[model samples]
Target: MKVAALLIADPEGPDPCRLVHGAPLLRHAVAGLLASGCADRLVVAVPKSALGDCEVIIRAVPGAGSRCRVLACGADRAESARLALDAAGESADVVLVHDVARPFVPPATVRAVAEAVLAGAEAIVPVLPVTDTVKLVSGGVIESTSDRDRLRVVQTPVGYRPDVLGKVCARGSDPLSDLPGSVRTVAGHPTALRLTTAFDVAVAEALLEEQG
Candidate 1:
């Protein structure tokens, strides 16, 4: 099965291009996906202003030159994902929508999601069991508590059949819940933590140090 990976390197966020472990976070995401050997092609969606820089960064990865394609993204994440999916084109049978912020996603997790899709699962997402106590609050008042055992923290890269994903994108529907087929889960690694703040960056740096 031919699989394609899509990454949205939105600059407006916590700066995906920020250095992590001596390399840009976007570079780590690209490199990890490539290392997975699951994606036959990769399409990265970046802001128009940062297209050149993003392209350069992706090309700098050891094996990305031939398989990676960088392009200007749309106004929002949904649009960016749609455009990237279109960029993946008809040739790609499976597509994985990944967050560039989660740069340290384990290659094995990537392969597992892809393998599930290839093995007849229509849609798959890597998820970790939620360990924290859940709460529902409104107006700063505690409303209810959620069952942690039944809750899972969703992670990327989310795998899907290209056609299924295309339909969801066209309707502007929620990919996780509105997907036409059943969504399954695979074990996610803690290393797949998303870098959304300075604290996350610090944690990722520490993780890198530990791995070394």
Candidate 2:
């Protein structure tokens, strides 16, 4: 199955170091993708404005020099993915969408999500079971406490059958803040570590160091 690690060379968020500044682990994100080894092809989505920087990055990253393609990433996640799906073509049996900033998206995780998609699951998403007590508050008062067992924090490489993803996007932007069930099913949680803050980056660095 062909796989794409649909990542934004520069994510919209403001933590920086999208590897744009040449952090030691920036290229390591591509290395993570190479671990998949299963993707018949690899592509990196960069802002149309950053092609030159992307070119330099690819050339600098050893094995990635000839393996990745640059596509236009849109303002939103779904749009960026739409561009990727279009590039994957009609024969792409399963598509794996992941974040580059995570850098820790394990190849095993990619393979697991892909396997779930190939297994005829309409949508495959990795989700961590909620570990904290959830509470609902309206204004200043607590309304109700949510059951932890009934909830999950979904993570990516949210995989999908090409058609299913198309259908969800066709409905226009997702209405809910949280991922809705209508879009997919849980594919089992993998090492989906998100990097949004300095602490997160630190955690990711430790995870990478351990992998070494």
Candidate 3:
């Protein structure tokens, strides 16, 4: 199965996913994906203005430069996804949309997703079970508590059949809210934590240290 991973990078970086441990979050993600040896193709989607910089960084990676492709992204996630999908072409059997913010996705998780796709699953999303209580609030007023058991916090490297994801992106549908078909889930690891805020980075760093 020819699988491709679409790595989304922050446009205005050096902040959220900045130079953590002297490497940009996007670079770290590329290295992790390459080490997995899962993706036949790795496409780094970055801001149009930042494409050159990202390309430079990707080329610097040992094996990524030859196989990986760099794309100029749009302003938002959906647009960026669309761009990546377009660049992926019709060759890849399955496509994975991964967020660079979640830099430490384990190779096992990536392999699991690929295996699922090869097993005929349409859409596969890795998720970590919700640990804390979740509630629906209205303007600071507590509404009703959501069932935690049914809740699975979604993580990326979300995999889909090339055509399926392409159609979704064509419709500009919000996959998070309106996925076209049935979606399957696999267990996620703590190392896949997304680094959105500074605290998240700290937590990810701690997780990495623990893993070491």
Scored by lDDT, the top model is 1
Off by over 4 Å in 3: 10-17, 174-178
TM-scores for all candidates: the values are 0.93, 0.81, 0.92
Please identify which of the two predictions, 1 or 2, would achieve the higher lDDT against the true structure: 1
lDDT of 1: 0.85
lDDT computed for candidate 2: 0.63
CA lDDT, candidate 1, residue 132: 89
User: Clashes in model 2: which pairs?
Assistant: 125-187
Candidate order by decreasing TM-score = 1, 3, 2
- What is the per-residue lDDT of model 3 for residues 94-164, given as tens digits with 9 covering 90 to 100? 88888888888998998888789778988888999999999999999999999999999888788888878
Candidate 2 regions exceeding 4 Å error are 9-11, 14-26, 62-66, 174-191, 210-212
Clashing pairs in 1: none
Q: What is the lDDT of residue 45 in candidate 1?
A: 88
Give lDDT per model, in order. 0.85, 0.63, 0.80
- How far out, in Å, is residue 74 in model 2? 1.3
Candidate with more favorable, higher TM-score: 2 or 3? 3
Kindly report the root-mean-square deviation of model 1 from the true structure over all alpha carbons.
Answer: 1.8
